[model samples]
Target chain A: MASIVRKPKDLIAGVLFLAVGIGALVLLREYDMGRASRMGPGYVPAVISGMLLFFAAILIFRSFRGPQEVLAAIPLQAPLAVIAGVLLFALLLRPAGLVVAIIPMVLLGMFSISRTGLLSAMLTAAILSAGSVLIFVYTLGQPIPVLGYWFKG
Target chain B: MIELLGNLQIGFATAVSLNSLFYCFVGCLLGTLIGVLPGLGPAATIAMLLPITFGLDPASSVIMLAGIFYGAQYGGSTTAILVNIPGEASSVVTAIDGYQMARQGQAGLALSTAAIGSFFAGTVATLIIALMAPVLAAAALTFNAPEYFALMVLGLVVSVVLAHGSLIKALAMICLGMLLGLIGTDVTSGTERLTFGSNELADGLDIVAVAIGLYGVGEVIANLNAPAEQRTAAGKAITGLLPSRADMRRIWAPILRGTGIGSLLGVLPGAGALLSSFVAYAVEKKISRHPHRFGHGAIEGVASPEAANNAGSQTSFIPMLTLGLPSNVIMALMIGALTIQGIQPGPEMITNQPQLFWGLIVSMWVGNLILIILNLPLIGLWVKLLTIPYRYLFPAILVFCCIGAFTLGNSVFDVYVMIAFGVLGYLLKYLDCEPAPFILGFVLAPMIEEYLRRSMLLARGDPTIFISRPLSAVLLTLAALAILAVALPAVRKTRDEALVEE
Candidate 1:
C-alpha cells in the first residue's frame, strides 16, 4: 500500500516490454521501411515493435490504478545452479566430451536440492553420466564424443 | 462416410505396422513416465525427446510425439490422484477430487474411473478427428493470404483472451515473441536483421532451442525454486481396480458431457485442454444435485475432468493438423517436429502426406488402448515411481535438455541460446506473465508476416482487402470481438474468477 506503483509485477513487465520495444526500434532504424506492397527486412519487425510499445504503455498506465499486486521473490540459487550446470555441460561437451561434461553438470545441479550429502550427489552424477552415455551415445548414436579432447590427447 | 472409411483404412494400415506400433508404445510409456513424475511436463519432455525422433520417418515421429501428449493426460491423473500433485496445468482440477478419493482409500476406484473415462473420451475424440479433420482441412484449403493472416490474428488474440493474467501484458508478450521470432535473416529480402554481428544468428534462433529453453530449462529452474519435499502415495494400498456398477452409472454422464465440452473447446486456439478441464469441472459441480460433495471424494469430479483433459488433448491436434496452426505449446512442438522431418503442415498434408496425417490419428486410439493397460494393471509401477524424489529426478531431465539442445545442430552455441531463454522465462514467471501466448506468437510470427505481406501485394497496398474479403473480414471481426470481450468489465470479472480457482 505504501509503494507508489500499485501493481509491482505489472510495472516490471511493462518496463521490460517497453525496453524491448525501444531496443527493437533502435536496432531496425537504419533498415528500409518499405511500402506495404513490398516490406523490407525491417518492416514487419518495426510494426511488431510498435505494437509492443502500445501494449506496454497500456500495461504501465494500468499499473498505477489497479489494486496492489505483489511480485514473487525470484529464486537465485536454484536457477543459477541449474544454468551453471547446463553451461558447463555445453562448454565441456566438444572439448571434454559427454562423459566429462555430464558429471560436473549433474554434480553442480545437485546444489539445488537442499540437505543433500556429497555421497548421494556423487552417486547421482556417476549414474547419470553412465546413463547419458548409454542412451545418447551408444543407443541413439548421437554424434557426440564420449571422451573429450582432454582425455584423448 | 465411405470416404471416411477409406481414409481410416489407410490410417489403420500405417498405424498397425510393427515399426509404428513399437514407437507408439515407447512414446506412451515414456510419456506416462514423465506424467507420473511431478516436475516434467509434456512440452519439456517432447522437446528433450525431439532429437531422438530425427532418425525416424515423419509419420512415426509425429505419431510418437502425439502419443506423448495424450499419454501425459492419462499419466497426469495418476499423480493427481495418488500424490496430490497434478503433473500439468490440465490436471490441476483433477487433483482436488481425485486426491480426496485416494485419501478415502478408494484410490483403485478413482484410478479406474479415470482410466475408463479417458479411454472412452479418447476413442470418441479419435473418431471425431477422423471425421472432422478432412473437412476442416478442406475448408482451410479455400483460404488465401488475407484469410490466413486474419486467422493468425484471431489465434493470437484468442490465446491472449484465454491466458490467466493481465490482458495487455499477454498481448505485449505476443508482440515480444513476434519481434524475437523475426531475428536472423529475413526470408523475403534475404538480409540479416538482428544478429548483433554474430554468425549463429544467421539461421535465426532454432525452434528447438527456444522451446527447450522456455519449457525445459526454464521450467526446471522454476521447480527447483520451490521448497523441496518428499511425496508419498495416498492410502496404504490400492485395491478394487474396477468401479462398482453404481459408481459407473454415476460417472457415465459426466464423462460424456466432459468429452463433448473438451472436443468443442480443444479445437480453439489456446490452452484448450487446460481450459476444458476447468470448465468441465465447473459444469459438473453446477449440475450435480449433490455438489457439496465435490471436493470431498466425489467420483464425478475425478471422472469429468480426467475425461475432459484427455479429449481436449486429442482434439487440440485438429487445428495443428488442418491449418498448420498450433493450438498450444505442445502442438507448437509437434509442428517443430514435422518441420524437422521436412514436412509442412497444412491443408495439403491430407493429400501430400496422407499416411502421416491419417496414421497419426489412428495411432492415438491405439495409444489410448495401451494407456489403459499402463494405468490400470500396471498402476503399481507408477506408484513406485512416485517415490523417486525430485532431487534425483531433475538432474537426468537437465542432462537430457542440455544434450537435446546440443544435438539440434551439434553446436554449443545453441546451448547458450537456451540458457538465455531460461533466464528470460524465469523472469517472465516472476512477473506473472504466462509463456503460452508468447510461444504461440513466436511460432506464428513468420507466417503472419508472410501472409500480411502477400495480402498487401495482392491488393496493391489496399489494407481493405482484409475487410473486403468476407472470410478474412469475419475472422478479423471475431478477433476484434475477442479483445473487446476481454476488455468488458463483466467478462473480465468472470475470467478472473475462473483462473482464481487455481
Candidate 2:
C-alpha cells in the first residue's frame, strides 16, 4: 500500500501560513484589545490576526483533502547567494564605502551564475564599483564616501 | 464642446511656453530612466527630485512632476517585458504575457504593442480628463468613509481575480501582506503596535523595499534558480520592433476596453491605478475565446494591461486636481509639490489658476507624445540590456537595488528589510503564491484600516454602515458579487478549464 503524500506544496504553504498566524497572534497578545465601539491600538490588529488565523486554518485543512499541485523543485544556492550578496553590501556600505563594499557583493552575485570565473567576476566587480562611484559620487553628488574609516586611508 | 476646446486652447498656449516645455521634457526623460531600471521606481524618483522642482514656478513644477508620473508608467512596461521585472504594481500584469512574448522571439512585437496601446490610452484618457473632469470629480466628492471602505474591498477582490494561481494561496498572500502592513506605529492613539522593539520597524515596512525585493530581487533569485541554458536572455530572439497586422487587429479591441476600465477606475480613491490593469486582464481572459493563449504570449494580454495602467495613471490625476484628493501615492506627492508652491489644489485650481490647470493638462498631452518619441528609439538600447550575461547583469542589478534602497531614506535599514522580503518573496513563489496581491495589500492596508475605523466610529460601531448608505450599499453589493463570481462553481470551472487548456 502506498502512503499518501498528496499535494506537498499545499501542505507546506498551509504550515507556513499557520506559523505566521500563530506568531502574529502571540505577538499581538502583548497589546491591549479594546471593545469594538471604542478601539484601542490593538483593536484592528487583533481582528486582522484573528482573520489570518481563521484563513490559515482553512488552508491547512484543505491541504489534506486530495492531491493537487506538486511542489516545484527550487534550488537553494542562487537565492541564498544573491541574498547574501545584498546583505554583505549592506553591512559593508557604512564601514567600507562603495568601492570596497561592491567587490564581495558583486562576487557573491556573480557566483549565482555557473560559468563565471574568479578573474572575470573580479573584473566585472571592479568595473561596476568604479562606474558606480563615477555615476553616484562624482556625477550625481550623492555624498557617499570614497573610503570609510574601516579602509586604510 | 466649444468651451472645452477653448479651455484646451488656453492650455495649449500656456503649455507651449518654453519653460513649461523644457521642464516637461526633463521630467519625462528622468522618469523613463528610473522606471526602466529595476531597483528604483517612480515614487522614490519623484521624492528625490521633489526638492529640485521647488525653485521653479508652480506650472513647471507640477508639469515636470506629472511628466515623471506617466513617463515612469510607460517606461516600467519596457522592463517588465524584457526581463520579467515589473518595477511597478501596474506593470505586473504586463509582465505575465509580456515576458512570455519575449521568450518567443516576439519581444519587439510586445514592446511595440505596449507603446501603441499606451499612446492610444494616454490620448483618450487625456481627452476624458479634459471633458469630464468636473463631472467625475463631483461624483468622487460624495465618497464617505463607508463608501471608501467598500471600494477598498472591491479593489482587493479585483486583485484576487487577476491572480493566475490558486485562489486560496492568493487570499492568504493578501492577508499576509495586511499583517505585514500593520507593523508600524499606529497613527491613532500614538501607539507602536508591531515594531518588535526595533526602531527601524516604527514606520512599518517600506513599500519600496517590499516592491524592490518581491518583484525585482525576487525575480533575479527566481531566474538564477533555473539551469544556465534555460535562463538565457530573450534579447537574442528579437526579429523586429513592430507588431504584425494580425497582432494589431487582435489587440485593438482589448486596448479600447482597457482604456475605458482604467479611466473609470482611476477616479476612485485608494489603489485605483493598481486595480484597473488587473480588472482589465481578468475581463479579457474571461471573454477570450482562446483563453489558453493568456499567460503564454497573447497579444491581447500585453495590449490591454498596458493601456489600462497608462490610462489609469493619467485619470488618477482627476481626483487630485479637481477634488484635491490623491488617488495614489504619486498624486499625493503632486499635492505636496502644489502645497510647496503655496497653492491649494481643489475646485479653485481651475477657476482661480486656470493658466496652471490648463497648462498642466496640455503639457500632459505634449509629454505623452514626447514619451512615445523618446521610448521607441530607446527600445533598441533597452532590448540590448537583455543581451548582457546574467553574471554581469545580476551584479549590476544587485548594486542598483542596494543603492536605490539606501538612497530612498539614506539608511541601510531599508536594505535589510528588502533582504528579508526577498527571502519571503522567493519562498512565496515556491509555494505558488504571487507577490502581486501581497504588494497590493501592502499598498491598500493603511487606507483600508483608516476607512474602516472612521466608518465604524461615525456609525457608532454599527457594521451596517457599509450597507446603510445607498452608495456604500451598492459598492459593497458589487464587491460581494465580484467575490461570488470568482468563487462560484461555474466560474471556477471555466477558469480551471482555461488553466488546463494552457
Candidate 3:
C-alpha cells in the first residue's frame, strides 16, 4: 500500500496558538506598569504567554518533521447533531420542562448512533427520559422545575 | 498512644452507627458500579449527587462520598481489563496489559488479582493516613503561593510525559488547554480574558462540563464511528473469580511495591491515582523476570497497577482534608459538599473535628473491606453486563451525562459547554492527541494563575522570589528537567517506539 500522507494541521494549530499567546502578552503590556522587581498585574500572563509562544514554536517545527498519516476524521454530522441537541435541551429546559426537553435531546443524540432505527431510538429516548425524570426529579427531589401549572402559579 | 486509642474509640463510635455504615455501603456499591461503567467518572457522579447530600448529616454524607470516590478507583480497573476502554484516567495503564490478558483468556485471574491487591493497598493506605495525618497536615501548612505555583509547573511538565505522544504535541495541547481555562473572568482583576462577550463565560468553563463533554460524550461519539467488525464481542470467558496459588505468588512483591509508590505519589497535588497506576505498571515492567509476559498475560501486570491506583485514590485525600487544598476535581466537589454542611476544610479541621477526622480514617478501612466483598462476588455480574447491547447502553449513558451536566449548578449553560467540549474532544482524538494532559492543564491553570499572582504580590513584584525559595527553586528545576528530559532526542525516540508498539 502507498504511504498515507498526513496534513500539517498541527502547524496551523500551533501558529494560531502562538498568535493568541502573543496577543495576550500584548494586551497585558498595554495595561501594566512594571519592572522585573516592581511587577504589575501583567507579570503572570506575560510569563505564561511567553511559555505558550515558545511551545507553539516547537509544535510548529515538529509538525513539519513528524510522520504524516491521518488516523481518522471527525464526522461533521455527529457534532452538528450534538450541538442541536444541547441547544434544544437548553432552550426548552424550563419552558417545556425536564420531561419534554429530554426526549428531543436524546433523539438528536442517538442520531449519531449508526444502524439505530428511528423507532428504537425514540423508544430508547422515551424510556431514558422517563427514568431520569423519575430518578433525579421525583425520587431525588432535586429542584428541577416541573411543568405543573399549580407550581408555576 | 492512649490518647490515640481514645480518639479511635470515639471514631469507631461515630462510624459504627447503623445509618453511617449503611450510607458507606451504599456509596461504595454505587461507586463501584459507576466505576465499572466505561464513560462515567466519580467526579461527575459526585457532582451530580452533591445536592442530594444536603439532607444527610455532615459525617455520614462525607464518609459515603469518600467511599464512592475510592471505590470508583477499584471499579474502574474492571472495564479497563475486560474491555480496552478505561473508565477513568487512573485505569488507562491497567488497560495496557489488563485487556491483553483478557484476550489471552485470563480475564478471571486479572480481575481477582486486581480486587485482592486493591484491598491490600487500601488497608495499608488507611493505616498510613491514620498514623501520619498530623505530620502531613503540618507539612502541608508550610506550602505557600510560590510553592504551589512551582508545583503546578511540575504537574504540567509531568503531564507531557504522561501523554504517551510527541512531547511537543503534548506541550502544545497543554498550552491550548490553559488558554481555554483562562477564557473566563480574571480572578484578581475581575476582567474577562477570552469570553468573546458571552455572559456564560464569566464564571469560567466548568470543569464538570469540560470533563463530561470531553471524556464521556466524546467517547460516545468515537464509539459510534468505530468499525462494526472491531466492535464485536471478544467472547472471552470469565469463569473463575479466584486466582491460583502461582498467580498469588507472582503478584505479591509487585503489590507491595505498587502500594509504596502510590502512597508517596498520592501526596503530591495533581498527581493521584492516574499517575500512580502508570508509574506502578512501568515499574513492574522494568522489574519483572519475564518482562515480555507483560503484554501477553502477566498477573503482576494487573495486580500492581490496580493496587497502586487504589492506594493513590485513598491517600489523595491527604492534601484535601489536611491542607484544605482540592487536588483534583473530586476533591473540589468534596470541598463543596463540606462547605454545604457548614464544615470548613483546613489545617485545623482535624483538631476541630477530631471524631469526624478519625472516624473518616477508620471508615476508609471498612470501605475497603466492603469494596472487596462488593467487587469479587459481583465480578460475574459485571462481566455479564459486557454482554449487554451497545445500542441500549449508549442511550442510558447519554441520559446520565445530560443529567450530570445540568445538575452541576442547575444551569442549562453547562449542557451547552459539554456539547462544545465533546466536539473538541472528538477532534483531539482524531488528531491522535491525548485528552488527559488537556484535562490536567484545564484543572491546574486557574490555581497556578492564582498562586503566581499571589507570589508576585507577596514579593512586592519581585520575580526573584520563585528562585529564592528553596522548595520553589527545586520544584522549578525539576519541571525544567522534566521538559528537557522528554525533549531529548534519545528519549523522544524511545517514546515514539513505545507508541508504535502500542
Candidate 4:
C-alpha cells in the first residue's frame, strides 16, 4: 500500500516536469534570432530543458526500479479550505475593499484550523482588520484602499 | 592603518546620527519579533520592507536592512532552542542541540550561549568588513560575466550538499525552479515565454509570494495535519539563562572556528547564512572530542552554528555592496532599492559615495549592539509568544502572508501565485525534497543566462571563449572538477553514507 501511494505521485511529478521542459523548448523555437555560433537566445533554454528531461527520465526510472518509501498522507480538508479562502480573498479584494475581504478570509482560516470557534474567529478578525487599517492606511499613509464608507474626506 | 582608522571615524560619524540610529533600532526590533515567530525569516522581512526604503537615504535604509538580517539570525536561534522548530533554515543545525538542551532542562543556558557567541562573532565580523572591504572590493573588480556565471555554477553545485535525500531529486527540483523562474516576459527580447496570456504574469512571479507560500503557508498546512497529541505543548520548565564554566569552555573553540569559516564562506555568491551554519555544524562535529554529544545537549553545537549564521548574515553584504552582485533574493531586492535611489553599487561606490559606504559599515556595528540589547531583555516576551495557541497564530500568519504578497504589486494575481506555490511547497516537502537549492537555482538562473550570452557576444560567437580567456578557463575548469569529484565512485559512496546518517 505504501509503495503504491508513493509511486503514483513520483510518476506524476516526473511527467509534469518533463512536459513543462518540453513546452519551454517548443516556445523557444518560436523566438526569432540570427544563426547561433556559440550562443543564441534559445541556447540556455535548450540546455536547461535538456537537463530537465534527463533528470525527469532518471526519476521515472528510479521509481520503477525500487519500492519507494511512503510517509503519512496529508489531510485534505484544511489545505482545501486554505486555498479556497485565499481565492475568495483575492476575488473580493478590490470590490469588497480591505476590511470586508480580510474579515471573511480570517474567519475561513480560523474555521479551517478547528480549534477557534465562530465567535472567537469573528472577534479576532475584526480586531486584526481594524489594526491593519490603522497601521497601513492611517499611520503609514500607504495607498491601499479602505472601505468606501470609511474613507477619509 | 591610518586610512582604516579614518574610515572607521567617518563611519561612526555617519552611523551616530539620530535618524540612522532610530532606523537601526526599528529594523533590529522588528527583525527579532518576526524571527521569534516561526516561518518568517529575514528574506521575507527585507522584501516586504524594500519599497518602504525607497524614500529614505541609501545609507540609513541599508543600515536598517542590515540590522534585520543579523537580528533575524539571533532571534531564529531562540525559537530553535526553546520550541524545537527552526525559524529559518540556518537554525536547523541549532535545533539539533538546542531542542535537546530544552528537553534536558537547559534551554536557558543554550539560548544564552548562542546569543553570546553570536554577539562575539558579530563584533569580529563587523571589524573584518571595516578592515577588508577595500581589498575585497578591489579583488572583485576583475570579475566579468563569464567569471560571474562560473561562480554561480560553483554555488549551485555546492548547494547540492544541502540535500540529505536523493541527489537526483534535489537536482530535479533545482531544474524545476529554474524553469519556473523563466515564466515571465524575457528581458532581452520583450516577449512573454510562459505567461499563458495572463497579463498579470508579465512581471513574473513575485519572490515574496513564492517564498511565503512555500515556507509559511505550506508549513501551516503540514502542521495542521499532524496528530493532536504531537501538537500538545512540551511545557518545559525554565531556569537561569547562563552557561556553566565548562559549557563556555567547550564552546569557545567551536565559536572561533565557526566565525573563521562563516566570514570566509559568507563572501561567496548564493552560499549565505544558512549554508554557513550547516558547514559550521559539520566542521564542529568532525573536530569534536566527544562527537556523540552533538545530537544531544552540546553547547558547542548550538554556539558554533548560531555564531556562524549571524556572522555570515553580516558579511553577505560584501558581494552586494562591492560588486553590484546580490548573493541572494534579499540582496536582489536591495539592488532594486539602490537603483531607485540612483545609486549603483560597484567598485566605484566607495569613491563616489564614501558617506553611504562607510555609514553602512558603521551602522552594522550599531545594529549588532542594538540587537543584543533588544533581544536579551525581550527573551521573556518572545517566550510568551510561543505559548499562544497555534490555531490563533496560523490565521495571523496567513493574513500577513496574503497582505505581504498583495502589497508586492497591488495585484490579486500575486496572492494566487503564492497559493499555487504553497501547494507546490507542500508537495515538495512530502517528497523529501529540499527547497533551498531550488531557490538558489531560480535566483541565479537569469544572471547565469545573461552572463553566458554576454561571454559569447564578447568573443564574437567563438566557441572557444569559455577556454580562451584565462580567468574564465580557470573558473570553468574548477566547476568541471567539482562536478567530476562529486560524480566519482569513491566520493559517491561516501556521500551516500553521509546522506543515510543525515
Better of 1 and 2 by TM-score: 1
Docking class of 1: high
Which pairs clash in model 4?
Answer: none
True contacts kept of 4: 0.44
Give the range where candidate 4 chain B is weakest over 10 consecutive residues by summed lDDT.
B228-237
| Candidate 1 per-residue C-alpha lDDT over B276-367 given as tens digits, one digit per residue, 9 for 90 to 100 | 99999999999999999999999999899889988988898899889999888888888888988999998999999888888989999989
lDDT of 3 by residue, B230-250 (tens): 422245557677877877888
Q: Residue A99 in candidate 1 has what lDDT?
A: 86
**Native contacts, share recovered per candidate:** 0.85, 0.66, 0.39, 0.44
Per-residue lDDT of candidate 4, residues B1-502 (tens digit):
8998899888888898998899899888877876777656666555555545545677878878777766766677888888877777778889889888888878778888888888888888888988777986787678777777766776676667534566777788778778777667777777776677888878767666787677767877777776542312245556777777887787888889888878887776554677788889888889888999889888888888888987887787787777766676666656656766798887778878888899888888888788778877777788888777777776777777777777766777878988898898887777667776677677667778788777777777775877777777887787677667777879877765543422
DockQ-better candidate, 1 vs 3: 1
The superposed Cα distance between candidate 3 and the true structure at residue B337, in angstroms, equals 5.2
Q: lDDT tens digits, residues B1-502, model 2?
A: 8988999999998888888888888898878875665534566456445545666788888888878876777778888888876767678889899989988888888888999899899899999989877665566566788877887777677657644567778777778888898889887777787898988888887776666677557777876775543334454656688777887789899999999999888776545766788888889999999999999989899999888988888898886787665555566567767876999886667877888888888888889888888877777766575456566776777777777667656788978987888899888888878776676567667777888888878988889888879988997888788678878888987755433312
* TM per candidate: 0.98, 0.80, 0.86, 0.90
Which residue pairs of candidate 1 clash? A96-A148
Quote the RMSD, in angstroms, for model 2.
5.3
lDDT of each: 0.87, 0.78, 0.75, 0.75
